[model samples]
Target: MISKTTIDQVYEAARVEEVIGDFVQLKKSGSNFKGLSPFTDERTPSFMVSPVKQIWKDFSSGKGGNVVAFLMEHEHFTYPEAIRYLAKKYNIEIDEIEQTSEEKEQANEKESMYLVSEYAQKYFEKTLWDTEPGKAIGLTYFKERGFTDETIKKFGLGYSLDEWEAFTQTALNEGYQLEFLEKTGLTIVKEQTAGDTKRFDRFKGRVMFPIHSMSGRVLGFGGRILTNDKKAAKYLNSPENDIYHKSKVLYGIYYAKQAIAKEDNCFLVEGYTDVIQMVQRGVENVVASSGTALTPEQIRLINRLTKNITVLFDGDAAGLRASLRGIDLILEQGMNVKVCTFPEGEDPDSFSKSNTYEDLVLYLEENAKDFIQFKTSLLVKEAANDPIKRADTIRDIVNSISKIPDRIQKEVYIQECAKIMQISEEVLYNTLAQINKKEVNEASKKIRQEQKVFEVVKNDPLVEKVDVQYELERKIIEMLLLYGNQKQKFEDLVLKENEEGELVLEPEIVEAKVYEKVYLDLQEDEIELSNEQFKSIYYKLIESLNEKEDFSVNTFLSGLNQEMVSEVSSILMEEEQYVLHDWERREIYPKEKQLGVAQLVGETILTLRCNLIKNRIRKLQEKTQDQHDDNSEILEEIMNYLQLNKLLNAKLNRVLS
Candidate 1:
């Protein structure tokens, strides 16, 4: 468990924008920051970070919470893991007590696998530097590849020993379970006919490359075999497990994320060494697909950092034509992609190793070509003297352009393609239209088929009715959260006999804290929030506001559970989402909620009272109609309730029918 003092230090020192900015590129919008939603595939910026409140909300996914909750949601970190990550990021020393055996065993399965993988990485690193065979084989291979000691250690490069059971036996001896070892694919286990189990190292005699998530947690490993065993594959990766999915994991993302955001571009390559060599040569913003085909999940990981991707390719790569298709995926995500190839005999690794840093940087800048230009040039060469092939190539280029979401960008690309191919713009536009129409038709067909499987209900009356009480209660909570600490003048309504002998209501103006006025009004009327979550949060919020002299939303949020934290953040940030659009620029001014806090509060209370009285009147009328007895008293009570409801509605400027 982390000490309370250390947790407090982390919360105080850590800035929400700074921490989230490492993963999601945030831009300044008013007092808050806005970015693409990491939780959803959104082109518009719906994810908001309020530095003032120290909270973030993703309107697309309806997920909102404090800094700790964001980590837990985005990175899938446990509560303790998130706190520790913050502590490490902010350079706060953690004071932690060792867990007991029972507590250690209580960790979930995924966490256990993570711990085992983490231990295996350390073990391999220790073997690389501390043992003889590791230095002789693995260390020599890396050094020969032109990697420095600092570079190797920075990426956590290591090597597994040649013996079959070297890693397996060591992990078992250290009290790590064999089950987790097998699960993480570190140890391969076999059961014998004699009822005994034989376990061997999975990456035996291979150099290790640890693959990490965006937050630098070791999810799995990529190992390269050194021996010339024709039967064995040259490279192997950890099998699919709960913690690691190869399609979603990118090599060197943990190291390259900051640079990618800073440089505003990502250099994509084909292998682990390509990323390392480029980063080592001062080109730090690079990631690898690990020689696999590109996936939307992988592209989205880069999308979070930047919208520009420059793919680096070897000049003599055998699968160049096949890999060109992957560039279409990038374009589909509405990202700008460019392709750069090295000399005939070199790849990014060899080229970076051979050239000086300045030369490498200059060569990339000069040689990089836009996707349309590169594709047209390459395919035009192949389609030389063949009209049909050239026509197909033109269609292919147009197809790629059709995937872009922005209409203006698509049109610009179409014009460019027309110029490069010596074709008319009308032809390319027609081709794009056909492709788009086909896609829309296919999508409609899919939706129709899905509709056939289930009954479609239209305009359900129950779905259309507004929950008036719920909205008013939500408004009350929102007001309390935003203006509870501020002092405001309010009109207290007093019902008494006016100048006449009849009863009438009078208003007496008074000054008090917003929270105090709200609390007293609710207590006097005996109104309790109908929603359980709102009720629980309402009392806690009042208690917190009353106890603290200096109120902080971030500090107040720290004391609530996850559910309460989400509710409070949503209530507080509801108005902020609209404020980001800068609507006043269009000469349309929306009323600011802060300008009339007192009026808003009083009106909301009056509305609540009116709603409650109307409900009472409704029930009394229903009882009088159902019962044959007790007619006079029920009728009188209903008349009195109607009068009170009318008075409250009048104060709210609401017409009662």
Candidate 2:
């Protein structure tokens, strides 16, 4: 278990904005930062981060949380892993009792696998430098490709022995399980037709590349075979598991994220060596698709860091045509894409390495062209003198334009395309409009079908029979969260004597705080809030009123988890948005002394809950009504309220005090 002091330090040190900024490109908007939604495909930004509140809310997905919560959500780190990441980033030292061998045995399987993977990364790195075969096979391959020793070590390259089961046997002897090895795709198990099972290594005779998550946890591996085995595939990759999703991952992104953010443009290449060589040549903001077609998920991954991407392809026309489809996907994401090609026979790797960083930089700068122009010049030549082919090419460009989600951008591109093609803008506009109409019609038809089914299914009488009182009570609980801490009191009955020297009907004087009154009123009626969230809020308000201090929303809502933060922040913030404006704010309207309704309500509801909670606690001492109790100060206050109520009721009933 982590010490409480360490946990508190972790939470305090991990600023929400700073942590999330490492991934998302955020722009200031009022008191919050807004950016495109990382979890969805949207042109407009719906992701928000509030530094004052130390929370984030993705309006599109309704996900929100503090820094730790984001790491858990975005990178899928567990709580401890998230904490450890923050500690590392912030340079905080973590001192914890190490788990013994027995405790290690007791660890969960997932954790055990993580530990094994981490250990293997170290082992592979150690072997690369300390063993002859690793240095000969892996280091030689990397160096021959212009990789520095530092790059090889940084990427954790290694070589597996040619002997079958070499790594598997070592792992099993070290207390790691064969099942885990097979499950992780590090070892392969095959059965002979009429004999026993045969165990072999999956990455045998291949150089290894350990794939890592953003914070550098070894998630999986990619290996390239060296032997001429016609039956076996040359390149082997880790199977998809809990931690590895190929479509969502970019090779070398973990190391290149900072450089990408700094440069504000990612240099996208098609293979691993292309990335390593370019970066090794001082082009730091580079990543590879590892020879796969671009995916929206991968594009979103890049989108998280920057909105600009420049793709590097072989200058050969064949390579450009092959990669043209991927460029359309990039443009559709609202990213700025420029296509740059090398001299006919060269790719990004060879070209970048052959020249100095400055020369390569200048070369790419001169060669890069906007997508439409690049596409047109490259294709117009091929379709020359063929009117039908040229028309088909124009349609292809229009279709790519239609993929853009932004209206303004699409219009600009359409005008640009028309100008470049010497065609009428109206014709292109009509073509785009028709395509858009078809897509919208198909979408609307699907929505209507879904709506029709939903309407038919939602005719249940029980759905309409939900209690309104429960909803009102829930809202009251929310109101208490707003005004529970404000200092306000309600009028209660007070005792007085009549002119005849006897108790008479009169209004009683007693102070009841707003929060205490609300809490006690609900408690007195035994009205359990129907919603679990409201119930929790209610109990917390009572606890705070009993203590008589400022309520801590942070403490009250701790461990409610990420799924609940958005709902809770909405409920807590919606009633305050009105007061957040300029004219009604304190800084703007202090002379008028006008308070926005939300500010007023936020203040009032908090005190109301506080007072209600006070009343509920005072009622606990009903046994000591109108009587003095020296046991405690709270007991004395309870006696006073009881005595005051009794005297007023006696006066109303014409009874003696």
Candidate 3:
């Protein structure tokens, strides 16, 4: 367990915007920061981080919390893991008690794989620097590739000894199970004769490049053999494991994430060396496909940072053709992709090594072509002097354009393609239309099949209705969070029996804290929220207000678990987002809620009271119909509730539905 002092130190040191900003591209929106929702696929910014409150909320997914919670939700980290990540980010020393054997055994499979991968990364680095064979072969190979010691260490470059059991034996001696070892593909385990097992290292005699997740955890490795052995593969990567999916992982993302966000553009290369070499040469906003085809998941990873990606091509004809396929995928994700080809004889690794940082950047900027231009120029040459091949190329380009989600972008690309192909714009549009129609039909069929599966559940008579008061309960929580401590004067309407023996409303002015008024009103009406989660938070807010003069959202959130933080964040951010909408630009200026805090707070509590009274009346009417029940007292109480309900409805300007 991490000590409380360490956790507090982490929380105080880590700023919400600064921490989330590393993973997300956040822009200043008033006092808080706003960015596209990393938790969901969104075009507009719905994820908000409040620097003053030191908490973040994703309105789209309804996930919210402090910095640690964001890491857990985004990275699927455990509680202690999230705390440790924050501590590491902020450079705070973690005071953790060692885990027992039972605790060690209780770790999940994925975490165990992670542990093994991390251990292997460390072991490889030590071997590369500390051992004779490692230095002679592995270190020499890296130096030959022109990677500096600092660059290699920055990217966690390592080496595994050539011996079969070198790494495997070390891991076993350290108490790591072979189960995780084989699972992470670090140890190759085989059954030997006489019911014994044989284990060997998977990456023996190879210079290792550690693949890391966005938050800098070692996921796996990509190793390249230095020896010219005809039988062995030149490059071998860790097999697909619980922790590392090659298609989903991007090489050097850990080192490049902040630079990508800060530079507002990601530089895409094809190899691990390309990314590291470029970063070493001061081009930091770069990542590699790790020699695999680009996946949508990987694009989405970059999409969280910026929409603009400039894929650095090796300039070899075959390599460029292979990388072009990912451009359509990038377009489909609504990202603006550009291509930057190095000189015909060079790749990013070779080019960066030979040129200065300024020259390399200049070359990239000068040579970068938008995907449409690059595709047209490259393909048009292939279709030279052949009309049929040209026509086929045009159709191919049209199909790529159709994959784009944004209509405006599709139209713009259509125009650009038509002009370059010297074809009429109408031709491209017709081709795009046919492709779109086919896709729509296919999508409709899929939707119909999915809908049929859910139809029975939708029509089930046993489906429970949502609680009617949830909205009001949520609003009550919102009010308390926003303006609970503010002093306000409210018009307290009192019901008195007049000479006519009828209840009359008398208005009286009362001044008090908003929470004080809300508490008193709810207590007098004997009302409580029906939703257990909302009820818990409502009381916590009140208790915090009662105990402290200065209420801190961060401090309040520290006591709650992730789920409660999400619930409270949803309540608070729903109001914040509602307020953020620029209605004034549409000539619909909304009245600020703070201008009528007393009325807003009073109405919220009154609405809750009104709902409770209505429910009571419903039960009373049901009881009145019972043949064996005596309901005289119930009817009298119902009449009093009805009178109070009318006064509340009048104040709210809401007629009973």
Candidate 4:
């Protein structure tokens, strides 16, 4: 467990803009910074970070939170993991509170697996340098492959000792449980005759590559055996476990994520060496599928960084066939896919190593083809002198184009495809329309089935009634957040009798801070917010004011949980965006709601009280209509509520019919 003091230090030292800037390219927009949202695919920037509030908001996805929350959301880190990451980044020393034996035993399964994987990573790296066989074999193999000492350390390359029980014994001596070791595929266990287990290392005699999550935590390892054992597989990977899913993990993502976003493009390769080699050669925005078939989940992972993927393949027949299989999946994700084929005998790893950086880059620029052009040209050659084959090839190209979500992009591709295939645009349009209509009908059927199931549950009598005052209560909370500490005088209407004995109104100004006025008004009216979230925040705000003479939003935010912080950030950031838009420059002035902050606060409380009283009057009338009840008290309460409601309505300028 991380100590609370260490967590506080991390939060205090880490700046929101600096922490989030490592992943997204932020540009200055007035007081806040705006950038393309990493959470969604878009050209226009909607992600905003406010240094003043120590929080960020993505208007596109409606996700707003503080620095810690951003790490947890963006990188899939746990709360403690995110804290530790920030501490490491800011160079803060962590003082951990050790867990008890029973507490360790009762730890979450997924986290235990993660802990085991991390320990194994450190163990492998240590063995690679300290052990005799590791240094002679593992270190030599990496150097022979042309990896520099810096690159080896950057990727956390390591080696496991050739002995059977070296790693397993060391892990056991360190008090790691056998169950987690077996689950993480770090130690293989076999039952013995004496009811004890025999354990062996899984990556024995192999050089190790630690695959990391986006936050740079070790998820699993890919091991390559050095000895020429014909019977054994050349490469081995960890089995599917709670912490690591092979289909969702991308090799070198931890190192390449920033470069990918910065370049606004990603280079997709086929192996770990390819990614490492390309990155080492100055093309930093590159990742690989770890030699697995490209999955939709993997494509979506790259989609988070950028929408453009350029597949690098050796110009071999089998390699080109394999690379073309993934283009449709990329198109389905609404991403643009381009293909760059190297010389017939080379891959990213070999080619990057053999050629100069400028030569390799120039070659890629000249040869890169859009997916439609690549697909059309490759297919047309095979379909030569056969009309039936030519027609089928055209349909296949149209199918890929129809999978694109953007209508503008689809139209553009269709025009290009028609020109290449020597077909009329009208024919291609009709084919695309038929495909779209079929897809729409299938989607509509699925949606209707889901709605039928949802409607049954939604119509249940157990559903609670909607509270009408929820919006008014939220308005009060919003006002306190925006103008809580400011001092303002509010005009209270005073009713007096004139010479004619008719009631007349005069304005009396009473001065107080917004927080004090809001608290006193709510207390006098005996009103509480009906919404639970707003009510909880109201009390927290009051407690904050009581604790400090001058309240700062950043200080108050430090005490809130993740959910509350996100809520407060969303409220605060929405108003900031409005101001940054600067509508006044275009001769369109937006009304300043905060200019009458006192009036807004007073009106919010008054409206809530009036609504609550009207509800009470309604209940009283229902009781007065009951046949079995004594109705005199209910009738009197209803009459008094009616008079109070009428007065409130008059004050609000509502005509009573």
Candidate 5:
């Protein structure tokens, strides 16, 4: 187990905005940060991070928590893994015991696969540096490709041995399971006709490139064969498994995330070496598609960092035209894409390797053209002097423009395209309208078909009915969380029988901590929160507030479990989402919750009392109707509750009827 000291140190050092900003593109909204929800598919940003509170909330999926909870949810990390990740990111020394064999055996299958993959990465690196075949072949190959030793090691580039079953046997000897090795595609296991198992390294005799998740966990590997064998494929990737999906993973994202966020643009390349070469040349905000077709998931990964992408291409690329279609996917994501090409016969790998860093940066800046301009220029060459082909090209560009989600951006691109092709804006607009109409018709058809299978339910009255008690309880908790440590003067309402034998409420002035006032009011009435979660949090919050002279929401949250942390964060951040819209700038001023803390606290408590009294009155009337006997006592009790409720409502300025 990790030591308490280390965990507390991580909590203190890790900033919510800084950590979450790595995964989501956050923009400053008031004092907090807001971004698109990573937990859900959303166009509008519903995820919020409060640096002050050290907590985050996703209004889209209703998930909220502190830093650790965000990691666990977004990265699917176990508690210990999340803590360790934070520790590593913040450069804190972890104090913990190593897992024993028995403890390692207790890990789940996906974790086991991760362990095996990580172990394989280390084993390969060791072999590449320490062994004869690794140095003579693997090291020689990378060095020939212009990679320095530091660059190779920084990317964890390694070499797999040539001998069949060499890695498999060594892994088994080290007590690593064959099951996980095979599952992660490191070892290939097969059954022969003699009923014996044959095992071999899947990436035997290949130079290794370990693939990592956005959080930098080893998920899989991409191996390149050095030998010129006609029967063998040039490059092989790890097969689709539980943890690794090539379509969803972008090479070098773990390293490029920071630079991409800093530069506000990502450099997209075509191969692993291309990314390595560029980063080695001091261009950090770059990633590769790993030679696959660009995917929406891959685009979204970049989308989380920035809204701009500059795609690099070889001057003589055979697949240049084929690759142009993928740029449409980027445009569809509402990202501004620019295409850049190198000199003939040179790719990002060779170009970055040959040119000085300044020259390379200059070339990219000078050559990068907007997707519309690049597409039009490239396609215009193929359609030269052919009126029919020119019209088709115009429609193609319009189709690409239609993929953009922003109408203003689409209009801007269309005008640019019209200027380039020397075509009238009206014709392009008409073509765009036709394309949009077709798309909407197809979407409506799909929705209609889905509606047939799924019955629609509407107008459920209970769905709309406000749960006054629950809201009051929630409001009480919100007040306690926000103003619990604050000292304020309050007018306490004391119910009593007056000289005329009528129930009346008299205001008694009192000054105390907000938490103290809430606690005393609830204690005096002997009222308990009906919601179990709120009740537990209520007591824990009060205890924490009473104990700490300098209470912190984040520090207090660190002591609670994930569930309670989520609940408290959601309560605290619900109003923060509204604050993100800057309503004051729109000339709509909202009532600030902090300004009337004392009055809000009193009103919330009084509302709770009123709700409970109404519930008691309801139960008493039921009893009077059921018994039909001497319900005089119950009736008198009900009358007294009604009078008290009336007095409380009157004090609250609420209509009794």
Candidate 6:
């Protein structure tokens, strides 16, 4: 177990923004930092990091927690792992109590997999540096590509011996399980027809590249063959399994996440050597999808760090055509994607090796074209000298433009395309509008179908749902704000069951704030949140209710995690929609949009409805006999709910049909 002293030291030394900024890209949005939601696929920034509170919130996902929580959510680290990660990040050396070998043997499967993969990485690296064949083959291959020893070590480059079952035998002897090794694609196990199973190394006889998750856990491996075998594939990758999903993995994200976040832009490449060469040349904010076509999952992985992506493509016409679809996927996510094509016959690896860093950067800067323009022009040229294909090409570009989720981006691209194609802007706009309309109609139809399947659950026919009581909620809000500022006092009672069967109140009582009052009351009555958003708002409110000062909305907003703030802000602002505008204003009884007073109203209303429904449900549950049929019980509930329905209608100022 980690000591409290160590935890405190780690927390104190760790800067929330600095720690989180390594994994998620953050930009200054007022006092707090905001970036694209790491939890969701988004274009606009919704993830927020607040250094003041030392917490982050994803407004889109409605999840906000402190530094440790962010690690748990983003990296999928366990509690102890998160703490250790923080300790590692801040350079706080952990001095843990040693466990016996027997106790250490009790480690779980996932941790064992990690250990085995890490061991394989070390084994491969050792083979490369420590063995003659590896040095002659794997080491020489990397050096020939201009990769420095430091870069090789940084990327965890290694080599596998040509001998079958070399790694598998060593791992098995070290007490690692073959099942996990096979699952991680580290070992290839095959069953013989007449005898028992045979196991061999999957990456045997190849130079190795370990693909890592963002937190530096070994997810899988990529291997390249050195020997000439006409039938054998040049390079082989680890197959997808529980731990490694190729679509979601990037080649060098472990090294590039910080640089991408700091630079506010990512340099995307096609291959692993390209990433190393580019970063070595001072283009640090770069990663590769490992020579595969970009997936939405892969794009979202980059989306976690930066919104601006500069895709480095080869100058080969075929490679460019093959890779254009991936560029379209980036734009679909609402990210700004720019293309940088290297000189003819040169990839990023060769290009950077041949030119100075400034020249390379300048080459990319001068050549980088917007994905829409680049894609359109490429297809336009391809369709050239073929009139039938030209008409199809325009439609194809329009279809590509239609994939963009943002309205403004779509409009901008359409205009650019119209200029390039010598087509009317109106025609492009009309095409885009038709596509959008069709998409909306299809989306609406899906929602309607989904709703139909669950309509009964959404409505409560047995009882009238209560309207929220705004005034009482206001009182609670006031109490939370004021009482939180002051020390809380609550009536305390002490009871001893051993000597006497009597309960007595303690002599000294403490003050209670609205948060404590509400929280304690809910706990005492066994009340729980029925929805996740309300649950989030409730927790954040509870968190802030104790702060001693005048409430500042911006500070409150900034303190909450990124995703929840957007939602809470939107909800709080949405509640003021009933406000009388200047033109429509004749008499305004209650002032609107003044501040969080709207949020307070909305929260109060929601709280009242939830509580009222819960109470009614509870009462109905108690009265309903087990012998009674569902139809009769529901009828009885409706009869018993008339007064509550009248009260709800009166408060909401609307009748329920």
Backbone clash pairs for candidate 4 read none
Displacement of residue 23 (Cα, Å) in model 6 is 2.3
Task: State each candidate's clash count.
Answer: 0, 30, 0, 0, 0, 16
Q: What is the C-alpha lDDT of each candidate?
A: 0.90, 0.73, 0.86, 0.84, 0.91, 0.74
Candidate 2 — what's its lDDT?
A: 0.73
lDDT of 3 by residue, 1-657 (tens): 777777777777888898888888888877788888887877778888889778888888878988778888887788889889888887888876765545656888888788778888999999999999989999998999998889888888999898989999888778788899999998888998889988889998899999998988888888998888999988899999777889888998888898898888999888988988899999999999998999988898898899899988886877677677899899888899999887788999999999998999899999999899999999999999999999999998998898888898988998899889999999888888899899999999999999997998899998888776998888877887778888989989888889998777778999998888888888887777788998899899999988989887877787788898878777666656853575666798767788989888777776777778788899988888874767789889888888888877977788866
Candidate 1: regions farther than 4 A off: 99-101, 444-455, 461-464, 580-582
Q: Write the per-residue lDDT of candidate 2 for residues 1-657, one digit (tens) a residue.
A: 666577677777777778888788887777777777777877777777777667777767767667777887877677777878888898888875766656667767766667667766676677667889888877788888888988887787777777788788887777777666776778788889988888998878788888776667788778888778899887787887666778878888888888898889998988777887888888889888877788988888889889999988886777677788998889878888888888889999899878999999999889888888888888888889899989988888899889887789888889999998889999999999999999999999999999998998798555666554454555565556555665443444223577887544353334445576666655664656666766765676677656857555554444455555555665654423333343554565443212332334333333333334445655766645655655477676666555554543343343433
Ranking by TM-score: 1, 5, 3, 4, 2, 6
Q: What does the lDDT come to for candidate 5?
A: 0.91
lDDT of 1 by residue, 1-657 (tens): 788788888888889999999899999898999998988887888999999889998888989999998998888888889999999998899877765545646778888888888889999999999999999999999999999999999999999999999999998777778888999999999999999989899999999999999999999999999999999889999999999999998999999999999999999999999999999999999999998999999999999899999999898957777988889999988899999999998999999999999999999999999999999998999899899999999999999998899999999999999999999999898899899999999999999988875544444444556788888989988898889999998988899887767677798999999889999999999999998888998898799889987878888777788888898888878887886677888887999889999999999998888888888888888898899986999999988888888777777777878
Which scores greater on TM-score, model 2 or model 6? 2
Give TM-scores for every candidate, taking all chains together and pairing residue i with residue i: 0.96, 0.79, 0.93, 0.89, 0.96, 0.74
Candidate 2, which segments miss by more than 4 Å at Cα?
Answer: 96-113, 193-195, 227-232, 457-460, 464-530, 537-570, 573-657
Best by lDDT: 5
| Model 5: per-residue Cα lDDT over 332-396, one tens digit each | 88889999999899999999999999999999999999998899999999999999999999999
Error of 2 at 240 (Å): 2.3
Global CA lDDT of candidate 1, please?
0.90
Model 2 sits at a Cα RMSD from the real structure of: 8.7
**Model 1 residue 262 distance off true place after TM-score fit, in angstroms:** 1.0
* Residue 632, candidate 3: alpha-carbon lDDT: 83
- Taking all chains together, the TM-score of candidate 5 against the true structure is 0.96
State the displacement of the C-alpha of residue 393, model 5, in Å, after optimal TM-score superposition: 0.9
